[model samples]
Target: GKAVFDATRPDEVRQFFDGLEPFDHLVLAASGGKGLGPFATLDLADIGSGVDEKIRPQLSCLQAALPTLNRSGSVTFISAVSAQLAAPGVAGIGAINGMLLTVAPILAVELKPLRVNVVAPGVIDTPWWDF
Candidate 1:
Protein backbone atom coordinates (compact mmCIF):
# COMPACT_ATOMS: atom_id res chain seq x y z
CA GLY A 1 0.00 0.00 0.00
CA LYS A 2 1.41 3.36 -1.00
CA ALA A 3 0.44 6.39 0.99
CA VAL A 4 1.86 9.72 1.94
CA PHE A 5 2.96 10.13 5.55
CA ASP A 6 5.49 12.07 7.54
CA ALA A 7 8.46 9.91 8.38
CA THR A 8 9.78 12.39 10.91
CA ARG A 9 6.70 12.00 13.07
CA PRO A 10 7.17 8.72 14.88
CA ASP A 11 3.50 8.36 15.61
CA GLU A 12 2.60 8.98 12.01
CA VAL A 13 5.19 6.55 10.77
CA ARG A 14 3.95 3.93 13.20
CA GLN A 15 0.37 4.46 12.28
CA PHE A 16 1.05 4.26 8.58
CA PHE A 17 3.00 1.04 8.78
CA ASP A 18 0.60 -0.45 11.26
CA GLY A 19 -1.96 -0.47 8.50
CA LEU A 20 0.26 -2.30 6.06
CA GLU A 21 0.69 -6.00 5.50
CA PRO A 22 3.99 -7.66 6.34
CA PHE A 23 6.61 -6.60 3.81
CA ASP A 24 9.88 -7.94 2.46
CA HIS A 25 12.23 -4.97 2.49
CA LEU A 26 12.37 -1.42 3.73
CA VAL A 27 14.29 1.37 2.07
CA LEU A 28 14.83 4.54 4.03
CA ALA A 29 15.35 7.36 1.56
CA ALA A 30 14.06 10.27 3.53
CA SER A 31 16.36 13.29 3.38
CA GLY A 32 16.62 16.55 5.30
CA GLY A 33 19.45 18.50 6.95
CA LYS A 34 21.42 21.70 6.77
CA GLY A 35 24.85 20.21 7.25
CA LEU A 36 26.74 22.09 4.58
CA GLY A 37 29.70 24.41 5.31
CA PRO A 38 33.16 24.51 6.79
CA PHE A 39 33.52 22.74 10.12
CA ALA A 40 34.69 25.88 11.84
CA THR A 41 31.81 28.03 10.63
CA LEU A 42 29.10 25.37 10.35
CA ASP A 43 26.09 25.94 12.50
CA LEU A 44 26.22 23.35 15.25
CA ALA A 45 22.48 23.19 14.96
CA ASP A 46 22.86 21.75 11.46
CA ILE A 47 24.59 18.74 12.90
CA GLY A 48 21.78 18.30 15.32
CA SER A 49 19.34 18.76 12.49
CA GLY A 50 21.13 16.01 10.62
CA VAL A 51 20.48 13.70 13.53
CA ASP A 52 16.96 14.90 13.98
CA GLU A 53 16.10 15.00 10.30
CA LYS A 54 18.00 12.01 8.97
CA ILE A 55 19.04 9.60 11.72
CA ARG A 56 16.02 9.81 13.95
CA PRO A 57 13.47 9.39 11.19
CA GLN A 58 15.17 6.38 9.67
CA LEU A 59 15.62 4.65 13.02
CA SER A 60 12.10 5.44 14.09
CA CYS A 61 10.66 4.06 10.87
CA LEU A 62 12.67 0.89 11.28
CA GLN A 63 11.62 0.51 14.89
CA ALA A 64 8.00 0.99 14.04
CA ALA A 65 8.18 -1.58 11.26
CA LEU A 66 9.90 -4.24 13.31
CA PRO A 67 6.67 -6.03 14.06
CA THR A 68 5.77 -6.30 10.40
CA LEU A 69 9.25 -6.65 8.97
CA ASN A 70 10.33 -10.11 7.91
CA ARG A 71 13.49 -11.33 9.58
CA SER A 72 14.64 -12.72 6.25
CA GLY A 73 14.15 -9.35 4.62
CA SER A 74 16.52 -6.39 4.46
CA VAL A 75 16.76 -2.72 5.32
CA THR A 76 18.60 -0.35 3.04
CA PHE A 77 19.62 3.08 4.21
CA ILE A 78 20.34 5.90 1.76
CA SER A 79 23.19 8.16 2.71
CA ALA A 80 25.69 10.37 0.94
CA VAL A 81 29.22 9.63 -0.29
CA SER A 82 30.37 12.64 1.66
CA ALA A 83 30.73 10.25 4.53
CA GLN A 84 33.67 8.64 2.80
CA LEU A 85 35.10 11.58 0.88
CA ALA A 86 37.83 13.79 2.28
CA ALA A 87 36.49 16.92 0.67
CA PRO A 88 36.34 20.19 2.57
CA GLY A 89 33.14 21.77 3.93
CA VAL A 90 31.44 18.42 4.28
CA ALA A 91 32.51 17.53 7.79
CA GLY A 92 29.11 18.21 9.26
CA ILE A 93 27.19 16.22 6.67
CA GLY A 94 29.90 13.62 6.48
CA ALA A 95 29.84 13.10 10.19
CA ILE A 96 26.10 12.71 10.05
CA ASN A 97 26.20 10.19 7.20
CA GLY A 98 29.17 8.52 8.81
CA MET A 99 27.11 7.89 11.89
CA LEU A 100 24.73 5.77 9.84
CA LEU A 101 27.58 3.98 8.15
CA THR A 102 29.11 3.18 11.52
CA VAL A 103 25.89 1.74 12.89
CA ALA A 104 24.95 -0.32 9.81
CA PRO A 105 27.66 -2.96 10.19
CA ILE A 106 26.90 -3.39 13.85
CA LEU A 107 23.22 -3.62 13.10
CA ALA A 108 23.93 -6.18 10.40
CA VAL A 109 25.40 -8.39 13.10
CA GLU A 110 22.78 -7.60 15.70
CA LEU A 111 19.82 -7.90 13.41
CA LYS A 112 21.07 -11.39 12.53
CA PRO A 113 20.06 -12.99 9.26
CA LEU A 114 18.38 -9.75 8.38
CA ARG A 115 20.50 -7.74 5.99
CA VAL A 116 21.31 -4.14 6.85
CA ASN A 117 23.11 -2.13 4.24
CA VAL A 118 23.82 1.48 3.37
CA VAL A 119 24.13 3.06 -0.06
CA ALA A 120 26.13 6.25 -0.20
CA PRO A 121 25.64 7.94 -3.52
CA GLY A 122 27.70 10.89 -4.68
CA VAL A 123 26.15 14.18 -5.60
CA ILE A 124 23.17 13.90 -7.89
CA ASP A 125 21.71 16.78 -9.86
CA THR A 126 18.37 16.60 -8.14
CA PRO A 127 15.98 19.35 -7.17
CA TRP A 128 17.35 19.09 -3.64
CA TRP A 129 20.38 20.99 -4.86
CA ASP A 130 18.26 23.82 -6.16
CA PHE A 131 18.72 25.50 -2.82
Candidate 2:
Protein backbone atom coordinates (compact mmCIF):
# COMPACT_ATOMS: atom_id res chain seq x y z
CA GLY A 1 0.00 0.00 0.00
CA LYS A 2 1.16 3.52 -0.69
CA ALA A 3 0.86 6.09 2.05
CA VAL A 4 0.94 9.74 1.21
CA PHE A 5 2.77 11.96 3.66
CA ASP A 6 1.57 15.49 3.94
CA ALA A 7 3.70 17.88 5.90
CA THR A 8 0.98 20.50 5.87
CA ARG A 9 -1.21 18.29 8.02
CA PRO A 10 -0.04 18.62 11.61
CA ASP A 11 -1.98 15.59 12.87
CA GLU A 12 -0.62 13.33 10.18
CA VAL A 13 2.83 14.67 10.78
CA ARG A 14 2.47 14.14 14.50
CA GLN A 15 1.24 10.63 13.94
CA PHE A 16 4.41 9.88 12.08
CA PHE A 17 6.27 10.57 15.30
CA ASP A 18 3.81 8.97 17.64
CA GLY A 19 5.67 5.99 18.97
CA LEU A 20 9.14 7.17 17.97
CA GLU A 21 11.60 7.44 20.78
CA PRO A 22 13.56 10.57 21.39
CA PHE A 23 16.74 10.84 19.37
CA ASP A 24 20.11 12.18 20.35
CA HIS A 25 20.28 13.95 17.04
CA LEU A 26 17.90 15.05 14.30
CA VAL A 27 18.87 15.56 10.67
CA LEU A 28 16.85 17.62 8.21
CA ALA A 29 17.62 17.01 4.55
CA ALA A 30 15.54 17.13 1.40
CA SER A 31 15.92 15.91 -2.17
CA GLY A 32 15.27 19.31 -3.60
CA GLY A 33 18.38 20.61 -1.93
CA LYS A 34 20.52 18.24 -3.97
CA GLY A 35 18.80 18.37 -7.36
CA LEU A 36 18.36 22.10 -7.54
CA GLY A 37 21.93 22.87 -6.55
CA PRO A 38 23.55 22.28 -9.93
CA PHE A 39 20.94 24.11 -11.98
CA ALA A 40 19.58 26.92 -9.84
CA THR A 41 20.59 28.69 -6.68
CA LEU A 42 18.55 29.07 -3.50
CA ASP A 43 16.61 32.21 -2.68
CA LEU A 44 14.07 33.64 -0.24
CA ALA A 45 11.03 32.07 -1.85
CA ASP A 46 12.70 28.70 -1.75
CA ILE A 47 13.51 29.24 1.89
CA GLY A 48 9.97 30.20 2.70
CA SER A 49 8.51 27.17 0.98
CA GLY A 50 11.27 24.82 2.10
CA VAL A 51 11.12 25.86 5.70
CA ASP A 52 7.48 26.67 6.16
CA GLU A 53 5.90 23.50 4.86
CA LYS A 54 8.81 21.06 5.07
CA ILE A 55 11.42 22.07 7.62
CA ARG A 56 9.34 23.84 10.24
CA PRO A 57 7.29 20.88 11.38
CA GLN A 58 10.30 18.67 11.93
CA LEU A 59 12.08 21.41 13.77
CA SER A 60 9.06 22.21 15.85
CA CYS A 61 8.47 18.59 16.75
CA LEU A 62 12.08 18.14 17.72
CA GLN A 63 12.01 21.26 19.79
CA ALA A 64 8.90 20.01 21.55
CA ALA A 65 10.71 16.77 22.24
CA LEU A 66 13.85 18.46 23.44
CA PRO A 67 13.02 17.81 27.05
CA THR A 68 13.33 14.11 26.38
CA LEU A 69 16.61 14.42 24.50
CA ASN A 70 19.98 14.02 26.11
CA ARG A 71 21.07 17.35 27.49
CA SER A 72 24.35 17.20 25.59
CA GLY A 73 22.83 15.85 22.40
CA SER A 74 23.17 17.64 19.09
CA VAL A 75 20.59 18.77 16.57
CA THR A 76 21.71 19.12 12.99
CA PHE A 77 19.80 20.56 10.05
CA ILE A 78 21.06 19.95 6.54
CA SER A 79 21.08 23.15 4.61
CA ALA A 80 22.23 23.74 1.03
CA VAL A 81 25.35 25.29 -0.47
CA SER A 82 22.93 27.29 -2.54
CA ALA A 83 22.62 29.50 0.49
CA GLN A 84 25.93 30.88 -0.62
CA LEU A 85 25.29 30.55 -4.32
CA ALA A 86 22.74 32.62 -6.19
CA ALA A 87 20.81 31.50 -9.25
CA PRO A 88 17.39 31.42 -10.86
CA GLY A 89 14.41 29.92 -9.02
CA VAL A 90 16.56 29.52 -5.95
CA ALA A 91 15.52 32.47 -3.89
CA GLY A 92 13.29 30.34 -1.74
CA ILE A 93 15.85 27.63 -1.15
CA GLY A 94 18.58 30.12 -0.39
CA ALA A 95 16.41 31.90 2.10
CA ILE A 96 15.50 28.60 3.72
CA ASN A 97 19.12 27.53 3.92
CA GLY A 98 20.05 30.89 5.35
CA MET A 99 17.33 30.45 7.94
CA LEU A 100 18.67 27.02 8.85
CA LEU A 101 22.15 28.44 9.21
CA THR A 102 20.83 31.11 11.51
CA VAL A 103 18.71 28.62 13.40
CA ALA A 104 21.76 26.59 14.43
CA PRO A 105 23.51 29.59 15.91
CA ILE A 106 20.38 30.73 17.64
CA LEU A 107 19.73 27.31 19.12
CA ALA A 108 23.34 26.97 20.19
CA VAL A 109 23.12 30.29 21.95
CA GLU A 110 19.70 29.81 23.44
CA LEU A 111 20.17 26.17 24.28
CA LYS A 112 23.64 26.75 25.64
CA PRO A 113 25.63 23.60 26.31
CA LEU A 114 23.53 21.98 23.61
CA ARG A 115 25.35 21.60 20.32
CA VAL A 116 23.44 22.72 17.24
CA ASN A 117 24.89 22.83 13.76
CA VAL A 118 23.67 23.18 10.20
CA VAL A 119 25.37 21.14 7.52
CA ALA A 120 25.11 22.94 4.21
CA PRO A 121 25.62 20.14 1.76
CA GLY A 122 26.47 20.76 -1.91
CA VAL A 123 24.71 17.93 -3.70
CA ILE A 124 23.77 14.40 -3.02
CA ASP A 125 21.98 11.72 -5.01
CA THR A 126 19.21 10.32 -2.88
CA PRO A 127 15.98 8.35 -3.31
CA TRP A 128 14.01 11.58 -3.18
CA TRP A 129 13.86 11.69 -6.96
CA ASP A 130 11.76 8.52 -7.01
CA PHE A 131 8.93 10.44 -5.39
Candidate 1 clashes: the total is 0
- Residue 92 C-alpha lDDT in model 2: 56
Best by lDDT: 1
Largest TM-score belongs to which candidate?
A: 1
Clashes of each: 0, 16
Model 2 CA lDDT for position 64 = 57
Q: Write candidate 1's Cα lDDT for 1-131 as tens digits.
A: 46998888988998988987888899998878579899889998888988988988998988888889899999999889999999999999998889889888998999878899999999888987876
lDDT of each: 0.89, 0.62
- The residue-level lDDT of candidate 1 at 107 comes to 89
lDDT of 2 by residue, 3-58 (tens): 45554566765665564566576565532432243234433354456666656765
Among all windows of ten consecutive residues in candidate 1, which has the lowest summed lDDT? 29-38
Error of 2 at 58 (Å): 3.0
